[model samples]
Target: MTPKRLHLILLAFATTSWVRADLATNLVAYWDFEGTADNHSSASGGAAYHGTLVGNAAVTGGTALAGTGSLVLDGDGDYLDVATIVDVNQAWTASAWYRPDLAPAGTARMMVFETSGNNSFAISFGLRESGNPASTNHQTVVDTTPTNDLFGNRDIADTLTAETWNHVALAFTPATATVAGSVVTYINGLVSQTLVIPAGSTLIIPDSGFHVGTYRNADGRWFDGSIDEVAIWNRTLSRNDVTELYERGAASLGLTADLAAAGKAFVSVESSDPALGETFGTGLYDLNESVLIEAVPKDGSLFTGWSAPFGAEPDFFNLTVTASVTLTAGFAQDTADPDADGLTNYQEIVLYFTDPDLADTDSDQISDGDEVLESLTNPLVSQLNAVNWIAANLGGGTEPGDIVLTRDSGTNTLSFKLKIDSSETLQSWGPLLPAATSSSGVAAGLIAVSFPPPWVDKGFFRVVGEAP
Candidate 1:
């Protein structure tokens, strides 16, 4: 009997299998109950096969995983028969939302379709018992072909709460010369179980008629629940693809970008002017919208760069949400002295201790680069370029042999040095002081070394590091 249909919305692209118009390239059949029991999916040349609502099953509201309504199965004999959608079956993926009415029993109560003859594929959900290792209940079952040979019926163990909604996905990948084919099942986008096909065993996807809410060629085994968003894809879907559906509902699934980041930096993004903090993530964004993606660097590091999203230049931070993209950011450290100067970049920039770019920042007619690279002397002091300053310049001041630094001179380990460019704006300070001399706490002080040496440029001095 043809049951009267009610309000339903056609959701051709929002099948929970893929996102957007590009995803429709491989859709074989989509059973979105859009106001009727017809296939709401498109086909080659405007010819689409609609299903026959047999028995007392009718379309109703508030039971949809997506769109407006869903087909309710009465557990009596209600089922929808659909003709063969794809010929020459290969790798295929199917996703659906089923709401079971009660606890499933030993009876392989079919929730969907499977032909009972040769060249037929079976899809069902049951409380399987016979050969389960863990003795787990509720299985998502798939049989590649009804020929029933050495290979068939790959049962993916699962559990379903009665009267609640569940998202189920079945995927099969064809074997290649290098890799073996396998059947993977997902409950809510997480791989519930995986069954690997043995080597040399060629798996075949049957091309035959299938039905929803009943067993094929059998009078009974009617699905006692509702089914919605029954979609089929010609190709296999990855784990991320399933997760995209699970995280975002069918209404927000299609044509979204799976955004990600890696190494030293994170991302800050937003759309419609909402403020999103700078951080890395594995998130999805809708398509055909403008998205802000900015790279943020860490402490003591600079944002090395950005990759052009949506074919823009590296300088462009705004990205138009179009495709699934991974934006990677790079960061650099303060230790990287780009100019090959004597002082480290941190000492020059952070501490203002010396010039990072210029070897002769003070420009006292002697470059620190020339002192270190040419004369091989220490650039920290005015001129005494000894690696160990405590022994060499203990009393070598400019007064023809005045004590530059004396042991126990000023109640501390004392070290003095001339500063070049004392104009504050163009000034560069002396380098890091050498290790103190006496371990017994030297109170060294310089006794007013005969009036500082007359200099052409203003020279400043600093006393640093008290002896402990």
Candidate 2:
């Protein structure tokens, strides 16, 4: 009997038509915060722009929208002081994934820029919960001089979901003494508001201190939440660029900008027991996305393991889609006898070529386990001659019961018959007849052979094979 096999093959596919030029063209600084509070930027001749974590700020795992960790902050005094990375009075773009745990009482600053004096102006990007000086929830304040400042439009509340990650971006262009500039705000990669910079305003450089998660002076405006994938660009980003960042996430910026930017990776999932349940995370994904793969077994099936490619770590679920790969999850039925036969389902399918779902696979009255274990006969073929003999002769039959062969009826030229072997005390055995002489009357169906009473009483007989 050969073992029953089940194989499932699923193909994964994906396509995108959005064209992109350069996503990392002007990236000045970046912080993924994947277990560290360091900048991952290559700006200023590959210089490092690191920060020191202030009070109650920590990097925690499994909270990032794209990576393994995110920077968690408390509303008391948590902030990151990353000196100066961007020059003031120049075009710039800033973006991050933000999720606030609590609504701000007054203002919750996400990032702040300031000069090196006590009475100086500061540029701030934050959220305002209450309409203190303005009703708008999202704000980007640009301070031009010691006396004049530009505030965002006092519009409706931005309707942010609490504790849910959202992509936010701000692009600004400074105004010259004779020319007007503009500041734009984006929520989830879409432009939400735009404010025009009035002419005759002086451009002040905030090149002294830059901080994340607090106001410039740290006057109790600390951001109380998580921030991940913080990045800045030296130039204003187009609408398409922000949309791409929101769709593909921050980790894909450099990967998608490479010359050999592999477009998409697909994950093909399969299961050994498809009748139990379907699998997840089986589709085309961005080349830099992390996907979770899993399968849900039904009530009686047990998840055994995964097949090749992931066989080394069968229980590992998360996979980064760096390339196309196929995965197969294995499952086993827990029951021993699903059809209620005496034989275990494993023996019925693996040891004997019989259906586990059917106790009598050959449609004979005898069960499959009884045919193999007790009668010593093929469970896949009905024991027709033995069944007929038992029906007619009752208890007086002496017919050798287990031999079965299939051929055209009454075909005398088949050249095959049951070769019987005898063993005394169940040990040494030998063929009852010489090798040259087979059992007589080797025709097609319903043929019964019987030995003499003395021979039967002397030893046990077994059908070995069909020999000519």
Candidate 3:
């Protein structure tokens, strides 16, 4: 008779859920000061700078929203002329991470996209003081002449504290004949305020260019602060989209990966402290922490090359997590059998840790040949879902050893028993691994047997099979 065969081929997947968060498809420019002084960033085509850099304004590292850098404007007329001819009249969003170094002693125009000819129809933020740098707290500033009582409508309630990184996203849409929110401002993923742009005002696209760390005209007050992750969108973003931007950062866009094997690997993430990092998935590490992402391969196979700066070991690897990362791990089968136990190398690595050199790894007085080849135990099989059989083989760990149990393929519902802790004999088995049921699967087929992201560390598993 022929022996039964099972194959293991686990892979990582990014569903459509990953694409809906990023709203960068309509972004006109994104400036993340990673390297170079001016005109160095190409996130939005090229030459992200067209104006001049005044005083000692320079590019600095550390404390950035996306990359590991930011631009410091020294309040001394130091600013970057991002776009040489600002052409935004309606439906636009201006977003950036701002850390104010000085409070405005007087009314300061921190950043703006206003028409050179008409100043009322614009989007900006600044300290509402009326003199030199004053209180360290500022407010969200704006002015839609056609709407705000013929003057700029600055938010008196939403005050900004100096010397703190605040994610600011200001969006504007010309008021229509129908009732709708025209101007909206988001600070740290929360809506700060909304101003109604008058429908009667003329929506004018500025002729000069939008300014960063300063207003458009030369007379505009020089903003003294560190700026990072400045992004300009042609379309105003929804509140949900703005929240996603603040939460995911550049990851708002689908995480880019340099994976090798498409469907032969997976990356699981566990964030005991989300304040430091919370990213998940294979080839996708956007969090900040030390991590151990097991590169589980198919049965009788192993990872080819885990080529990423994080770590490069096979099934087990370590990484000092930083910002976003691009990773890929290769996979291939290992048919070499030095043990001559008829068990391949791939089976020993993934199915369970067994000495590739010794046919009797546990030295239980039984060779692997008698235990598996004859007893039909511990065969490497693909992850079968809860639907196929009541029970099946488990690719588990070593020690007290796991018993196999299974029913016919026609049965859809099944139950099993678990020995409390590590009970070698069935006489004392009781309780469960951790809870009443060690785990439960609610999905159809093999998809229901996956462990949660937090369970990727290391543990034991039991094998399942049909009764003789």
Candidate 4:
């Protein structure tokens, strides 16, 4: 039979939580040194803590580490009296990006916080030169109490590169009754050193003004360099947080451009959830954070793979974002038969109008492909639904016609023989002859028989016998 024979005239039709984390969680004050250089702490609801430039301490353009400008200190007397006062008795963190023009000097102060009268310094952190520009050490002096204080230094000479931008951060955790207070320093996103406070000491820095580019009280210990993106937090920063901060700042300066030039680009796979036809691994991610991305295909689609720059990466993969790059998840449209049924996705969706994702559209123990291609049954209507066998003549009188026979409920286990007799008059019928055609399944609970051609003046048809 031609494919059209199977297409018999008998027709029937029917119709992250992913979330990105905020990096500015407890930020108290931030000075990006762009424009007029007001406090950029709005993200954390901190005080304005505006900086008043002194001497030649001006926001210099085109010499920034991350943004458009940086605060330049002329080493002589230039400084910034940042009206910042915070409770340093608890946990805190301070970070900054600096590009020094000369090697570290013994008395060169980058940041200092002191009492209003400046009787003594509460905290002072800066660089100490060791006669060698390449062997600089970072120092911090903390006044834990009126009668207690501590001063120490950590050798960051290995990471010190004069005239180049570098990141420095110090985080503190207050001491408990049984534990000593500790200070952790990070250089370029790595742990440089940790200093433990005396067990009985507690940070006693009061609400005093903070200074940048010079020691408190406008002392001659002025910083000679460009400083950008200086920030302070009332809460301690974790290792990941510090790393993210450093990487984000470095990326903004395009430090990863060399890596990208070496044929490596940050890769991030994007897709929708299977239900929404999207991918997984949704949330805000740090530039240095490695993430696991997965491709999930929505209904009527398939995940082919990832796009270029990610050759041969599987549907689920891990990636570290060191630079700014966008990745695309590849997907094949709903034209494939993933279920491996006899029908293509297009045939199931467009022609047969069945679900392509399911091998069986109806829970009747028969797959959609078999129901349509084999039994010529409707895949959507379950065979369990009761349906009485019925017959109907589509046309009459010398016209091409169809005899439709419907199947009974439950199963197609019965067979029948049809016969016909023709006569000039209704009183006497001619010898019985087999019907023009035998019964064939048309759809679920339905079948049809087509008359070949030529017709007499009258005719009669009947089911002669049945086989169970």
Candidate 5:
């Protein structure tokens, strides 16, 4: 059958169960600093600069602007803004990978900012004491600087690699207590430190225009080295949350590059390569975090295009298999071939399907022909309770006339054998059969039979026919 036509439901008879899955988004933005060759200007007069691809990791063989580019390679201010787009008063986050040729002194190298007065805020990385340009001492600085207590600072003089790329991220929560609603910084994938403002700190700036590359104040420390994969989020990110961002950039970071585009919550920035890169802007707001973007496989489903090791579970639920039967099917006659391949019709119905002639239906293991003759319920069809019930009743009787049932773990099937004794009459046998057993001729003595080894496990078999 076509992959679309097969479906099956395998009931796992287990006391405990679990399924595995993952939840998160991998956002991509201008990676490798590749930008558009032509400068795109916003209505506010800010020019969008294109980054030129550099290094050996070009998207194309001969240095296509797809990966590895020099920032400001065109000499025009590779600056972009989100002042008109982002809601400044709400919580947000901004991050990037920057390698500056010159230490930003006396000025804020704005990664993301807005111009509105009451709702505006900015995130920058630079020297803590901006006045000393010649001094090598620098700190990972945030906020608008001393003008507001919102500044979260970390000393980075020892961490700065002059010409190498460094991953940086900042998460902001506006207007709340300093510690509760503030910014967090991550260097590489780890949180370097956290800054908190006291409850009544004066660093609140409600609205303002946001700028990237060079701060709007124009103190003149233009971002000289390459800036790649800049992103902005409308919500604050926790320390654990920032770790996710670091992971998304791990691929690029290993190559000394960033993802080719900005992903969700991404707005604007300057990079060395635009074509080899990508960045997100306004579209990120549409994603739903609660829903799973990927699909999972269900039990008894046919798995087409499945490749070896064969034992692993299917990755998705796109294919179908035979319809599942329930414990209610116990009353029906054995519809499957018995002893053809050493399987009973009841076993085949439990394991594969009602059609006994078909051997290895799904072709995974345990022959369909064999499953039929055993009278064992299909492991996929029988519920956990049913399996437990069979296990509990396997060998409880004392007299030779008592019935015994067992399960085969290797084949996952159930088996049964009846016992009759000279003392027991035929009338006693009537009560044991799955169906009503009536007296015939003279009452013969009962015989005793013992269940097999594999079927002894409490996990394997269940009663099908009534006592006879």
Candidate 6:
């Protein structure tokens, strides 16, 4: 083959693979009750291909069975059989929408039994054995829980609602051993509680036909209501998927043709096509939406009404600016300086921890007045720049004998005086004092030393003069 043709074929395959990655499998089973109308035999109703519902059981809602059905299993011989096509030993979820009638005496049970022994796993809802006739006891149990009294031994009670179509889901996981482990029940898309199953036990009864509506051997406790949209999955569904089912199911019942557009599949014992009655397949399950970023504040403050982004697609929402706005370089005093020079009280407190009231905050050994005069460092505890002052004044070309510093111990003051010899050039003087020394001194009798500022403490003067 030509190189051009081979490259084109490879590109086409790559494109197809990318498209297939976005698609997910759809699993749906539809059971429409419109075939050979049989009364008791499996042949009477549409090919007992899936199972059977006995005793005054017939599909209702529409003529062709495209709508709803009432599977009334109340009397001694009323039940529905769900034929086992696949082994459900792994994680699975079963859900249904049911509406029951208020019975007079006995409680109701929803059983899933095996074809052989009556000891198959089951869950029931109704009044407790000790419950008064007036109140109800909504109990849920597994096969491990004793079924001797049928109504007394249950893992959970007071969870079922009656006389209305309620969405019920049971999720099973094999790994968990706690009561909340193996099983979880959901009512109306919300998780109700975790169910406890027997250790080393599987909920799916092996080699047994899955039965619904009535207990295995017990009588008088039958589901006398309409069961629609019964679905079973090989895996537990996420919370989002459950919510989608509730919304789509409600929309479908409301006679919306675009109901599947809500991104969920509908499963039921009644099929839309007679040929597909026993078969389950995938349906509408794709809802692709884009996610956008949301902006938020960053002002280092607490936000009260903060909410995350939400929609059909992923969304990014902006958070209120909670970042701290640091006042960097705005203060008058330098943070690197231990003492603040000519700064206000607020600046001293914010920048350097110097006593804004006194010029020499730290009573080191030099006054603030002499520190400025001899080009010495400030003696404030925070602003004492002794190391930088010594490096600048003493380490340079300035002779050590030219600078002088005097401290009066009694008056607690310091005076810094610097005098230059007549022979010294003015250009050489510039290197000795980088700038003019603010002190009362005579520099070659030309530049007079004016006292810049006097401080109270003598020890606060950080400058000492070297004798000439």
Candidate maximizing TM-score = 4
The C-alpha RMSD of each candidate to the native structure, in angstroms, is: 19.1, 24.6, 20.7, 22.8, 19.5, 20.0
Q: How well is each residue in 1-468 modelled by candidate 2, as lDDT tens digits?
A: 323322211111122211223567778777767645544443431446676678877777536766566777766777776767677568888787777764543353443323332434345667665223233266666666533665622442477666677777778887777888777878876788787777766545654556778766766677777877777788988665676677556343321334235476546666676775456666547777899988767545567777654666544478887765656778776557877667776566556758888877886556777777776667888776665454343323246653233233232111124445666666676765555534565443334576766663332244433333
Give the clashing pairs for model 2: none
Clashing pairs in 4: 20-284, 271-278, 271-279, 272-278, 272-279, 273-278, 405-447
- Give lDDT tens digits, candidate 5, residues 1-468: 754444322233221122100112222122333434432221222333222232221222222222454234111243443343344346666666655544442234322222324333444554333333344333444454345534544565434554455667766565543443455667765666566544444343435444445444423433444555555556665544455455545444322222223322211111122222221111111122221111112222212222222114233222121111100000123444543555556554544554455444433233444333453435234344654575567645666645476666555455655543222565443333222333542234332345877665443433454543
- TM-scores, all models, native as reference: 0.48, 0.47, 0.46, 0.49, 0.37, 0.44
Cα deviation of 8, candidate 6, in Å = 9.9
Candidate 3, residue 342: the lDDT equals 66
> How would you order the candidates by lDDT, starting with the best?
4, 2, 3, 1, 6, 5
Better of 5 and 6 by lDDT: 6
Local accuracy by lDDT, each model = 0.52, 0.62, 0.53, 0.62, 0.40, 0.43
At residue 189, candidate 5 shows an lDDT of 50
Per residue, candidate 3 scores C-alpha lDDT tens digits across 1-468 of: 223222221112232221223355567776767676564444554565444455666777535555566777766677776554334555778787777665532234555223333343355565544233334334555544444534354544555666667787888776665544466778877787776665565444455566676665645566767777777777888665575566545342211111222211113332222332233343333344456755555556545554433334655666654433334455566878887776777666546567677776654333455456554444333223422332434323355556433333332223344433434575675332434322354322222256677754432354443422
Deviating ranges (above 4 Å) for candidate 2 = 1-19, 35-47, 102-122, 130-136, 152-156, 250-468
Q: How accurate is candidate 4 locally (lDDT)?
A: 0.62
Q: Least lDDT summed over 10 consecutive residues: which range in candidate 4?
A: 11-20
Candidate 3 residue spans exceeding 4 A from truth: 1-21, 48-51, 61-63, 84-87, 102-121, 130-137, 145-153, 177-181, 249-468
**Model 4 Cα lDDT, one tens digit per residue, 280-367:** 5543355667788777775556777665556488888887766544455777656777777778886787578888877777765457
Query: What tens digits encode model 6's per-residue C-alpha lDDT throughout 1-468?
Result: 999999999988754431211111222233333332322212212334465656655556422212444354443556666555234556666665655544522354443222223555433332243223235444455443322332234434444454655666666665434433355766666666676555554443534545555555435455555555555556666544465455545554321223334443332111222221221221223343221222222222111221111122212332121111110011121223233345444444543445655656566444454454553454454333553454345433445554455445444454455444432554433334434444555343346433555644333233445533
Clashes within 3 Å, all models in order = 13, 0, 21, 7, 94, 45
**Alpha carbon lDDT at 205, candidate 2:** 61
Q: How accurate is candidate 1 locally (lDDT)?
A: 0.52
